[model samples]
Target: MFDAVRNNRKIVQIFLVLICLPFALWGVDSYVHGGGAGEDPASVGDTKITAQQFQQAWRQQQDRLRQALGANYKSEEANTPEARLAVLNSLIDQRLLALEANQARLGVSDEALRNFIARIPSLQENGAFSMARYEAALSAQGLSQPQFEAQLRQDLTLQQLVGAVGESSLVAKSSTDAIMRIEAEERQASEFRFPAAQYSAQASVDAAAVKKFYDENARLFQTPERARAEYVVLSQEALLAQVKVADEEVKAWYDGHKDRYQSAEERRASHILLLDKDKDPAKTKAAAEAILREVQAQPAKFAEIARSRSQDPGSANKGGDLGFFARGMMVKAFDDAAFKLKDGEVSGVVQSEFGYHIIKLTGIHPGKQRSLEEVRPEIVAELKRQASAKRFAEAAEAFSNMVYEQADSLKPAAERFGLKVETSGWLAKAPKPQDLPAYGVLGEPKLLKALFADDAVKNKRNTDAIEIAPNTLVAARVVEYQPAAARPLTEVSAQIESGLKLREAAAQAKKAGEAKLAELQKGGEDKLAWSATKTFSRLQPLPAPPAAARAVFQAPVGKLPAFVGVTLDNGDYALYRVAKVSQPEAIDEARRKAVEREYSTLLAQEDFAAYLAALRARTKVEINQKALEASDR
Candidate 1:
């Protein structure tokens, strides 16, 4: 279950973002301004951090945190003083390093910046950078070309500094070999189970004792407040049904975007490849000729031969089929050969950078223009989308204005936009996945903020229209409010009783274990009298109990009479009076080699940290401590 989620798209995306955003400092703008932002946040090089600067940096950090966490974002946690202080400190540290980097004249060239920007996926379409798209995206994000470039440059600079450190760190063969050795080795062992009931003849807790224990820790049985709320949602999707596209508009759209309806010529082919690299040209020629003869002899079995003998791992599984690709997408020689061959025709082995190939033309598709009549429906839908977007925007603006002007009942605003003013029954401040009727729109930050606003809260008025996402808008009002209250004992009697029993049992166990340990310390050692508990190494399976193995290896090491108490998984406690502690010696040479590889990786990590520290030393940095602290304020 855990591994499945780890590979989920959202989880993987979050993991990559977390890895790249922080400690790695892999984002943009770390370099151009300076090597790093600064050495420390509060007092970098004797400069007091200013509140304004700290707030700005803190906001940016908050944005990064939000981006990284996505749906799991906790507004309160991010807005807290501790989080603000942490962000401020990071900003100061970056400033210090960036200043030092500048002093050392560590800069990125303009060409590098251009290349970096060009490579960004967001700015590309159809495998080529789109200037129009690049501009539109920057505009949407409210960033100018120069501003974006400068930030990118700064980011590149910081990366270079970090990369420099990583590159200098060498991975020793001895280390890698040790690691490889362990990876190639395996261990075999047997295990046994010693269940609690099997080990202890009688272990019980009385009802009276359970009740007493529950009285002492009653809070454990209490439940957090829960609520069911109602809301009204408005979004572009809601308005989509209201939009209409005329037939004339569809026809005009199709005529203007005719290129979109054109189909390019496509060809399907298979090949057998031969390579000239690392072998004599004459020898390669001989092998190609031999293979060609064999293919010619059994022309129908070319695919089977390619599947078994082709050197191209990428396409071999599909019998060396390149699928259908249009002209200009492949290398000149390969493209020419495939396009010239008729369906079912085979060509002699062709050579390219990867290798030589026996080409077989399987199918061909001729280029053709699509008629407007054939694509009219699609064009109409597109026109409707454009029209709908404009209409929705206008409706959204009107909705916003109506709420702002009225600032009272949602009835007025809702009537104006023909949207219902929805009300929630009650809602807790704790973040939750939207589950209310009108929550689709009300869950947005803007709507939530408005609902909590003094005007809305005091008058109990509806919130203004808020955009949750493109085209979606929502308006909501809180019908009733409830402050959190402690749950009554009667409401949680069963829970309390269960918790009480667990506590009483744990207490009893701990008392018995403690007395047993005291006796052992004095002279309870009668080898046969001592109790035995099975233990396992890290990553090893435990005996039948289904318990984790980490605890076994983490237990204290000593002879009999030494006791260490640890809480059991079931909330009970156990004291292990050490009879024996097994020491796991290092693995043999084969395993040792694998360990070495890991040790080298560890060394590289250390070296990288050291490099960052050095870069910090070289930068001339200053931080406004006062400003940073003010971020929390």
Candidate 2:
């Protein structure tokens, strides 16, 4: 999880910005200007959320959602007015928190920021900080060292404010006990289902009722506007197909960057760890030194001593063997000692963060560089990629211009770029498939909007080239069009009639189930068939009829058999007769503790939410409606 957080820096940065919003200031004047020269989407207190900043945040949210929903995700949903407004509101909340944090004089120090950055696993190599990798990652994201550091500092400062509120929350013992009692309660019950299918055979839907239902819900039967189109794409992948790396170029690259193919030396070592564990440092050190002295005198006993006494669980069972590791894999003190010792030699007691350790150097592997022949394919691919990138830079401008200039068709642009004008199957305004051939760009809201624009559709003209993805441009022209229209009643009459009959059946089932339940409550036994008794609890639920299971637990326990009725999802109605109720004799301590921790965490979250709400109440928040709406456009 930590590696994922570090590798997905863009997503993590956006999440930090959002989570830290409540601790930043906002400028009222920025919001008033509203997406103008130096305008903001909203403001809290006196800090402004700039248009660029808001846009980056919105895009980050879209990316996060896309990742979560996978192929089912749609970019068009995030482009809506409501979605944009939600993003703006989050920015406002962030500004409110920022204002409060600033007034409290909360801050993160330079040393703390450096430490935090150094700890990111993705920015490290072989478990050690690597400055080159860190710089390269930031450069890839278009952020400088100072810019990234400043954001990190801001995030840490906001964390301080959130921590204070969350830490103050306390869960009462009485509340914990009450919740556990209910959660542990169990009940046994029998149920009878009044299946709607039984009633449907007797119920009939008339023409008038079907027509009324259809007329009231006409919008549901309307077909969305659709089009068939021809499009051309200009992308790096497309350009790569036309790019070639000569043998000489590949050889030259390999010669100039031969050092990149070299691997560092690695060593395998073992150690008996004596963890600090809040014990006296001197005592811990003395114990480790005793083991070290014993091992030095008789190294053969090292493995037995490690298995019996080592505190490091990860390696203790393996006789403290850490396996093969590079220079930077271990902490500095431990790494230095292990590297200096000869194979089969043991080092004196050394102190580190985890306390003292007795090191044993077991094996060593020397580093080597690969020959040219071994890396020729890699060199060729790298060189080819570089060539294609250069070509894309030069051709992108020409592609964009050609599409706009030759507006009638994609043929001219396609021919100029040595590309084919691909045709697509019928596509809805909001295309269902994200990977639709030729019309894949229609999955993107902006391109779809442009393709269906009045002039583009009516004149059958090509759209201006639009970047649907990074370094990928697409332009489309409508070949066939269909306007939005409602499906006639004749076409949907059967569907409406079926729906009306189901509704009538459901009504009959509910009536019969209620009558049966009343009869049961009045001490009258009906000939209705009841399922076998089943036991359930909040923690252990029944397989079917969850509503009946829930009703069993909720039914009154005074009578010998308590009765309740519920309408099921599949148009069936269920009547339950709860026969028994039981409570645990005693709460399991471990389970109770787990539940307590969860309840406490929930309470802490509530406290944090209340704290933010209070900050908003105290501060003056201004949202520029026009600017907020314009950001969506």
TM-score of each: 0.58, 0.71
Write down the lDDT of every candidate, Cα atoms only: 0.59, 0.78
Per-residue lDDT of model 1, residues 534-602, tens digit only: 544333445423332333334444443344454466644454444444433554665454444445445
lDDT of 2 by residue, 1-633 (tens): 022232332322334454543322223223334443335677666556777878877877887787888755667655788888877778776666566767787888788888898789888643446576787899997778776776667667767777677667677878877888888888877778898989998889888987888888988998989998899988888988888778788778878998898888899988898888767999889888888888878789888889998988768889989899988767778889999999989999988765788999999998999988899888877777887788888889999998888898788889888888888788788656534554556667778889899998899989989887777889999999999999999999999888878888999999999988898889997676778987777776475577666677778889878888999988999887778888889888886766666676666656766766888788877778787778877
Estimate candidate 2's alpha-carbon lDDT, on a 0 to 1 scale: 0.78
Q: Which ten residues in a row are the worst by lDDT in model 1?
A: 186-195
Stretches of candidate 1 off by over 4 Å are 1-229, 246-248, 265-365, 371-377, 404-408, 411-425, 432-446, 487-502, 517-535, 541-551, 556-565, 574-594, 607-621, 625-633
TM-score of 2: 0.71
